[model samples]
Target chain A: MNPTVNNLAFSTTFNAAGARYRGIVLSANVGIMRDLAFNASYNIQSAAYIGIPQDILLQNTNLLDGGQITGIPLRQGTAGLSYQQRSGFAARIDTTYVGSNNSWNRNPFWFANASVSQTSGRVSVGLGVYNLVNSAAQQYGLIGAGVFVPQNYYGGGAFGGPTSAIQPGTEEYGLPFRQYWLTTKVSI
Target chain B: MYHNHGYLLSDDFASAKNDVGFGYTWLHQANTNGQFPYILCNGNTQNVFGTYPPLSLATASYFARDTWMPNDKFSAFATVWVQRSLNTISTHFDPRLSLVFRPTTNDVIRLTSGRAYSEPDPSLLTPAPPSYGSPTSVNCPSTTTGSGALVAIASEADPNLLPETANDVELAYGHRFNFSTSIQADAYQSWENQALLSGNVPISSIAQITVPQHLIAINIFSA
Candidate 1:
């Protein structure tokens, strides 16, 4: 994490000698009042390199074979705000947006969540939400190794490889990411 | 010697893997001699070190400091850190804290307390596996891949091993130089149990392995 004290910046990423990804970011904060205030910031990142971890691809360039994989997110936005009362009552809503990701990472969608609560009374109850949009989510991807094999000792079928019913990327091995759970908390 | 229909030399090929006292040391790659898949029982050595002697190791440390405060007693600080290992079966989390008190103003002295944590990077302490592995994975290429490197580390997940833990306490003092800018400092410390580290042993290293055709490298080492 390079520490750059900047309010905004423009950056670009290249893939296969082509302008793959580029983006601009905008952010600012101001005092709407004193105790009850508001602040919001948005980022617009567009790049053909959105879903892929390019560094990994670049590192293996010298391997025995080839193919190309890259990700692109046409645009993305993130914004949120909060409201609080001196009475210990507070509420907030947040938005995590992907502006129509046009690449393999998938379709652009926004996820919104909100919460409200008041601790003024004896019994306090808080209700929260997640994945309000319930947009289909992809947790991860499966990639295969190839082009060269260490002589003929053991093909990819070692490590109990083809022998066992277990394969990491296989659908049989549950992918750990997509979800929307409802949780509630009660305090006395 | 060839008269018996066999090419022979004085002790040319000694495939004496059956020697009783010859122990195998765990290595980075080739733990299987490229014979058995990862966990298949192929009569290979259960372990290179064949049950390495319960790994035994130890460490000790000490520190001292002199501090000053307003009441000639306001600024005070002290701390100590120590650890040890025995038979590759050990863990400890220890932290120390101390402070002095002085009253330059009415609100200078403070009673403080807190909980400190020294969890190793889940990746470092334990193995953080990718959801998937490159086709020709050396250690973990399949879902049998690994829950974490720690799982295969032997040092961790040795059913006998316990989750490391630690606890801490603190006390401090400070003063405001002005409204916008001020000087504030605190003296603190803690003691912990089960700090963690990889108990991994290295054996023959992995050479180069490639398979399929689209092979894209995630991490590989080649000269």
Candidate 2:
């Protein structure tokens, strides 16, 4: 059937027309002295919705054009330092930061990690700790779309409400808590 | 999901200044949801949901690539891909090109541009056919609502769905300060089209139900 693309109302999956993403990434590593080293990396990115799905746009009153895409961080950075000795001992520490995205304008969050290793002969052992500071970082998604109220539902029927009562369209993921691991390697 | 069968053949040719390769592949796949109830109308007990028949798809792909290093300081790589979906009567052609230059012993620059396409999930291509809840009968109680009242609910599949696609370009540079130190930077931009997502289509858009239906059908995004 040759139904208008926007008016063919059937619950189904379809393709969105347009989106754009642009970003810069930088990373570096340096050897400071005979036993010390340093490294860092930073990334900045931006995403925009150039066009909205025709059906969704028609169902909602608000427009999302030129708005930041949901679920993407705008900035991220990491820095690390390491120390090593000829005696087969090494240790390293690292920290990471992540900025908020278009959905929410909250403060940035960060976490740290540390690890140490010792190698003797053919056998070696190591210990590592992740989320060293136990930071409680969280991620959020986009707001819910406004509910569509047909003209017939104005006085009767059971379906009508403000969109504010609905939750965000996506789930929130919490960063993992602090954890530790011990590793060993043996050469045959 | 249905079973798949396919095969691939490839060959590579290498020389002092160039490396080339070619390959071909064929695949067949299918899917079904068996049977499950999707809607209940007027407090009826019997399952009124219906299901769709199994669906299958076949595809053939061919690709060729080559890397040429004309000298120690410059190189270029290119590849081309052609894919055809048999049942869908669709074909896609994708191409990529990359260039690399080493102006110094410890410094390098690279640039790349490409277009890529991803097929939709097989399950999404074969959702259960649309069905309407059973009407009021002797097996169920009837309220003041009109008789033969029905509410349509369905998980639909579109055979005409197209693959998602993206076009991207990237530039990068790297430098080494010593045997143990190095740095790199990159800039990139991309445009994506035909990204797929689940959405709702009010039944009112397709037909009108005279009776007030109390049950709201949830749109299932997963199996």
Candidate 3:
């Protein structure tokens, strides 16, 4: 007599995998005027996995292509300018850029921020706005249900599986939209 | 002949010229709700329960440093730091040494080395195993001849996980061009062990399964 058993399982665990990152950073600060200063910086980076196959697949069936490590952006840069007046008033503007790279998919984004504050005696107040342009860009990606489901549903065509069966895929998303706020600081 | 200031109350000893200092610091953190309660699953959608343990853990660290200046151009310093945790990991000891040399008024050089360690996250230290729902069998329709099935998967935590550790060496040089601007350069190399990551383990298998659906569970560990 012959006996047969069927079992399937999916699990995620942590391993001591290795990765390498190399990059260069350039920054400068210039005194545009007596009370005004300008600063800028640029960062360029390249990251790759070590001791792992370039095409290795994760538990979610997503391929780790190009030896790309997760959560590391290849290129990013920032520039800002600040001005301070003798009357205890200061204002600054900053902008940032993130080059497109793959977490799971390509994510390129940009945003700007500005603030103005006035100090009188012991109290300081300011107003600021984030995501000045309100650009819609995906900042992160993941593999999961309802987020990025790699599945197709049919009425038991060939395998006679339920319609809820899932395929393999990834999903991408960005951070919150533009926001504005006010702040106050008191010196003790 | 020597001159004495009122900075010291007792200066009779010859070693009294050396500086002595003492410092103490304390930190207390409490785990609260909404801090880390859920794990992100799939892509962006769907949240899995059981990310953190019900209990709370606290950690404390202390450090002391001493500096000795034998001459006007050179100084050496050493520090010892110790840390202890309540529930995550055992105590850790770290020692560091640094030497600074000033060859000229415009140039300064420093060499330093240290060992550092960090405990794992509370959630990862005590992880909630993934819970897969019951599996259901699907019968082949009139067109197909075989059957299929589906299941959900989750991950488990490792209790024997160790804290991450690293040994680092650094060399720094600084030169003053003028009072308003200066140039500094640093180079460092580090060797790290017991790094944490996620991996998949096959808990079960399926055979003769035409259309088998798998729910993979993952485990956390330090390597």
Candidate that would win on TM-score: 2
For model 1, residues B1-223, the per-residue Cα lDDT tens digits are 0111112122222222211111111111111112112221222233222211121122222222223233443543333333332222343434444444555552356443433333232222221111122223324212321221111212212222333444544443445544322333333333333433222222112122232232111221121
Runs of candidate 1 exceeding 4 Å displacement: A1-31, A39-79, A95-112, A134-136, A139-188, B1-223
TM-score of chain B of 1: 0.28
Number of the predicted model whose DockQ against the real structure is largest: 2
Candidate 2 or 1, higher TM-score: 2
lDDT per residue (tens digit) for residues A93-123 in model 2: 9998877752233346788999999999988
Per-candidate fnat, comma-separated: 0.00, 0.55, 0.24
C-alpha positional error of residue A111 in candidate 1 after TM-score superposition, expressed in Å? 5.0
Per-candidate TM equals 0.30, 0.65, 0.62
For residues A54-148, could you state the per-residue lDDT of candidate 3 as single tens digits?
Answer: 21232222224234455567777888889999888999989887776534343567778889999999999999988777765344544432233
The local distance difference test score of model 3 is 0.54
Docking class of 2: acceptable
lDDT of 2 by residue, B1-223 (tens): 4677899998999999999999998988765443454333333333434433445778899999999999999999999989886765778888999999999999999999999877877555643334443323212212211121112234456556778788999999999999889999999998888866555455455443332131123333234
Cα TM-score of candidate 3 = 0.62
